[model samples]
Target: MSISDAKVDVVKDLKSEDAKWVKIQKVFYKDPNGKARDWEFASRQTRVEGSELDGVGILAILEKPTGPEVLLQRQFRPPVNGVVIEFPAGLLDKNETAEQCAERELLEETGYIGKAFSSSPIAFCDPGFCNTNLKLVQVSIDLNDPRNVNPKQQLEDGEFIENFTVPLKEFPEKLEALVSAGYILDARVQNIAAGIIVARKYSL
Candidate 1:
C-alpha cells in the first residue's frame, strides 16, 4: 500500500508503562533571579550511553552534471496524522557515531550511500514539548559511483518512504509547493530550505 493508504488506525495517550522509546520527565532548577522553576517534557529513552544526542538528520546532496540536488523523503508520521516531507534521519545505536548513522540511515531510507563530511551542533525540537535533539550531518553523494548505479534501499519492515530530489536552487519553491499540497514539512527541512533561500537571495 502507498502512503495514502496508511492512515492512523487509532489515537490514544500512551501510558508510561507502555513507553518504549520515550518517557515523561520533570526538571526543577533555580532561575537566574533565584526563583525555583519546574518544567515537564518528554525525553527520549534511546540515546546512546554517555551521549546527549538522540539522532542525526542527514543532509544528502547529490552531485549531477547540471547542478546539485538535495535528496529528500516523504513518509507517514502518525503524530501529525499526515505524511511528512523530511530529510533522511534516524536515532543513534549504541557505540554508533553520528557520521556512521548518517550514512546508514541515508542508504536504508533512500538507497544512496553518501559521504558524511561534517555535522552541526546539537539542535532540539519543540523544547517546550519534548527533549528530542539531532545533529545535522552533511553528506555528499557522487552520481558517478558504479555502486550507486541501481542503488537499492534496505528499509526495515513497516517503513514506507518515498525518496526524491529537487534542485538546490529551487528548493524553497518546491518545499512551498509540497506544503500547499498538504504535506507536513519537518522543522529541519523547513529551516534548511529557508536558509538556502535566504543565503542565495542575499548572496551569502
Candidate 2:
C-alpha cells in the first residue's frame, strides 16, 4: 500500500519535549530469534503523506578535458561539530519525485544545474538509528552550458554550504586530503568515491 493509503494512528505520545524534525517512540516487535522485544527508535515525522522516500542525494558530475569531476559540498554539521564532505542532498517536498528533488537541491546548494540521468534503489541512511532513507540520483552537468557559466546558489538562511569539484581520478587523494585536514567524510560520499575508483580501475 502507498504511504497515503496506509493507516498510522499514534497509540501514544511518548516525547517529553517536542522536536521540530524528528520524534522518538518506544515500539515492540519480533526479534530475529523469534522473541518479542521492546526498542526505542527515531522516525522522521516530517515526511509527507504520499512521499515514498525520505530524501534525495545528488551524485552530480561534470565532464572536462582532463576527466569527469564530481560535485561535492563542504558544510559544517552541528551534530558533528566539524565540516563534512557530502553530496548535495535535501528532504523531499510533498509530492516531489526523487529526480525532481535532486535537480532542485543540486541547483540550490551548488549553483549547478544538472540533468538527472539515473537513480539508485532507495536506501537507508541509518536503519538502526532512524527511518531516514534516500535515493541516490546520478546527474550530469554540461560545463559548456551557458547557464552554468556564472551560477549562484539559492541556499536558505543559516545554510552554509561550499561547493567544490574534484577530478574522478584524484577522488581518493581528495578524500585523504579532507580527512587529513580534519574534515569528516559522509559515508555515502566515501562509498561513492570508492565506487568511482573501482569503476575506473575496471574500466567500467
Steric collisions counted per model: 0, 0
What is the per-residue lDDT of model 2 for residues 53-109, given as tens digits with 9 covering 90 to 100?
888889899978789999998887766666789999998988789999999999899
User: Candidate 2: lDDT of 17?
Assistant: 64
- Superposition TM-score, candidate 2 onto the true structure: 0.88
**Runs in model 2 lying further than 4 Å from the true structure:** 1-16, 197-204
Model 1 clashing residue pairs (backbone): none
| Global CA lDDT computed for model 2 | 0.86
Candidate 1 weakest lDDT stretch, 10 residues: 1-10
* TM-score for each predicted model, relative to the true structure: 0.96, 0.88
Over 1-204, each residue of candidate 1 has an lDDT whose tens digit, in order, gives 678667888988987669998899889999999999999889888888899999999999999999999999999998888899999999998889999999999888888889999999999988889989999999999989987888888989988989899999899999999999999999999999889878998999
